[model samples]
Target: MVDKGGYRMASGEAIEKVYYDGQKATKALQALENIWVKRDLILREPKELNLSRPSNREAVMMTIVGTAAPTECKSCTKKDGPFDGCFVVPGVARGSCNNCHWNSEGIKCSFRPPSANVDDTPAPRKPTTTALFKKKAAATAMTATAAQDATTTPAQAVTMTPAPAAANVTVGNFEVLPLILPPSMTNAQKRLLIQTFQNMIIVLENSLTDMV
Candidate 1:
């Protein structure tokens, strides 16, 4: 382990000690402000990177342990070129390269494209009040129609093209609707039907009297 120090900030904050073996090491501190890092991109000053913050101390404890590749930052390249100063802070925004890659506590710094947002989970969709109300109203209308049908009189329930007349006949608990006569029947036919009906009623009455 190569144990080293003397990494200090201009504000005189001391950088935590760093240890590096040939294969793995700790990550370097990142610039606290992006603007300062942008300015230092070309004439990169190693110490100008933020050396002292609570986050830095936390990062120092997490060891960078992995075999890093050059392609780690390749996905982040823009049309202009690799982002300004990306070479200096290899894994600051994304994947670890051979120069700066690290697996902090078994978590490798994987490459992420610059276009991607940190929180990629979709927002929860909400039910619309209008849709819910329409559904409820339709259900209510169906229920009302069912209730109206159940309670409707035969006179009210049937739709007829001819003039309609109804009579109710009761047999035990059941109620039966009389047959509807069409208005197109001739008066003579109507009189004949009435006379036949009266004759049948008289015969039924005489049979009942004999039984009594």
Candidate 2:
């Protein structure tokens, strides 16, 4: 046992010190009374005190003594675990129980007993961008080659023309003559053509009016 002064004492000496301090005055008065009654000197009985009993503060501190931090998960190296009898990972600070045989949070941890064999291989990693691109390009090239090898129908041709040329026409006999009207015929021809066309248009308009 150690005292407040940091001096080591035997267990018996510690108990004796506590017992003597607790009832020193009472024991001395009792000893004096006994001596007066007997008219003789006599040894006093040692008072005993229970030093094993703890104070309220000491009991409270003991209750919370080893609870300074949360535990961790052993499988994922993440700090989240049960309160007792479970060794956990040291980083992540929350979620899931470490003591359960199976973790329900999709962690895929099997809290096997001490005798079970544990696999040390890490989790599979996701595919890299370069690998994924290579795979996609290979698939695309295969599909393109397949499509090219497949049978294809030819497109139908189309022709268009308005009308055919006339056959058996004599090119030398086809004459283009210049106009030669007499001086007297020119005025009469103009008047006849213009006036006659105007009169015919007037007559057609009158007939349409009568029909309406």
Model 2, span 98-210: residue lDDT tens: 22222223134443333322432345889899999999999999998677555343463234333532222122333223233334445667556545555666676678879
List the global CA lDDT of all models: 0.38, 0.34
Question: What RMSD, rounded to one decimal, does every model reach?
Answer: 15.5, 30.6
TM-score between candidate 2 and the true structure = 0.18
TM-scores for all predictions: 0.24, 0.18
User: How many clashing pairs per prediction, in order?
Assistant: 0, 4
Q: What local lDDT score does residue 158 receive in model 2, on the 0 to 100 scale?
A: 36
Per-residue error at 82 for model 2, in Å? 15
Candidate 1 lDDT (Cα, whole model)? 0.38
